[model samples]
Target: MMILVFERVIVSLDLENGLYQEFSHPLYDYEPANRITLGVLRDCLCTFSSSEKFSDVWIMKEYGNVESWTKLLCVPQMGGCGCYIYTKPLYISEDDQVLTYFFKMGKFSLAVYDSIHDTLKIPAIQNNIHDLVPEAYLPEIYFESLISHFSQD
Candidate 1:
C-alpha cells in the first residue's frame, strides 16, 4: 500500500518497511511542487492546483500508476478577480457536483461547481454570532458517531 506524503515532492511511503519514493508524473512537473495539494477524491489520490485564472483538479484513477492521472475538472476563478490563493475540493455529490473551499483576499468560503453545466455556485452561509466565526477553517470528511457520549456508569 502507498501512503501519499507531501514534501518538496509527492512521496509514496511504504508503511511496512518504511521506504519512501517520489510519485512523479509529467503533468505535475509543470507546476512548482509546493503549489500542488494532495487529497483524496472519490477514493483516489488527487491533486489540486490553482493558477491566476483557473483551478484544476486531477485524480489518479489507478493507484501507483503515473499514467492513470487524469484531469478531472478545471474551475475558472470566480468573478475574474484574480485574488483567490487556493481552492481545495471538499466533496463530490452523487449527482457530480463538487464542493470546494477557497481562500480569496484573506477570507475563506465554500462554493459548489457543477461539472455538467460548467457553473460555480457560491452558497450563502452565515453565523449570526460574530464571535463564533473562526479565523481559519479546515474542512474534513467526518462520520457521525453512533455510540452515546454519556458514560454508562
Candidate 2:
C-alpha cells in the first residue's frame, strides 16, 4: 500500500508480511502552509497535488515504481483566486476525459480537471457557503477554508 508520512514523505508498505520500503518525498523546502495531498485513483492509480497557484498534479503510472511518478498536469492558479488548500479526486469520467475533484480553496469547491484540454473548471454549488478563513500548513501564516470530512471508499 501507498502511504504519505509526515504529510510530506510518500512510502509503500506490506502489512501482512511486516515489510515496508521508502519511496518518494517532495524535493522543495516545504512549509506547512501549502496544501499537499495524496490520493489513489480507481485501480490503485496514485495521484499527488501540489496545492499552489501553479499547482501540479502527479500520477503514478506504475503503482510501486518511484520512477513512474508522472506529472499528469499543471493547473495555473486562477487570477487572484484562493489556492486549493485541500483536494481529493472524486472520479474519472466514463470517457476518461474529465476528472472531478472535491477541492477546497477558501470554501469547499469542486474542480473538474479536463485532461483532453488541460484545464481546470470550478462548478457552481447551490449552497450558500460562509466566507472561509485561511489556514496554512507551512510555518508562515496563510488563510483558507478547512474541510472536515472525507470518505475512505
Candidate 3:
C-alpha cells in the first residue's frame, strides 16, 4: 500500500521575484487514472510541497528557465492502461519527492524520484506491497496528490 501526496512545489525561475503556481494535486471523484495529477508547469518556476511528506519540498530549475517546462504524466505501472508514452518521461520530475516513496513499493512505481539507490530501471514490485511501509499506510499516489492539493494554497 504505497502512498503519494503531491506537494505544491514552487519552481524558482531566473526571473526576479518568481512565484510558484499549483503544480500537482489530487483528483477526487474522478477516473482511476486521474487519481494523481502530476506534471510540470510551463513558463514559470517555484517551490511545491505536500503537507504529508517532505514539507519543505521544492522544484528548482535543474537547468535553466525556458519558454516552457514539463510535468510528468505518470501513474503506478499497474495503472498505465491509459497513459501515453510521449508524456511518461515528463511525468517524472526528479524534483518530485512524492515519487521517491511510492515507487519503492511496486514494479511500475516511482517514475521519478527513487529512494533505494540502484533502483533505476523499474524493478519488479508486486502490487499492494507492504514491505516498505506499514500495512495501514495510505494509498501512495492518492495521499500524495491530496496533500499537494491542500498545501498548494
Q: Return the TM-score for each candidate structure.
A: 0.72, 0.55, 0.21
| lDDT (Cα, tens digit) per residue for candidate 3, span 30-149 | 233322323333222322222221212222244243323433222233333221221222223445323343333232233343433312343355764445554345333222221122
Q: Per-residue lDDT for 38-65 in model 1, tens only?
A: 7888877788887766778888887778
For candidate 1, the TM-score is 0.72
Query: Candidate 3's error at 150, in angstroms?
Result: 26
* Angstrom error at residue 40, model 3: 10
Residue 116 displacement (Å), model 3 = 19
Candidate 3: lDDT of 138?
A: 37
When summed lDDT is taken over every stretch of 10 residues in candidate 1, the lowest stretch is 128-137
lDDT winner between 2 and 3, please give it. 2
Off by over 4 Å in 3: 1-34, 37-69, 72-129, 136-153
lDDT of 3: 0.32
Residue runs of model 2 more than 4 Å from their true location after superposition: 1-8, 26-34, 42-45, 80-86, 94-106, 115-120, 124-153
The lDDT-based order of candidates, best leading, equals 1, 2, 3
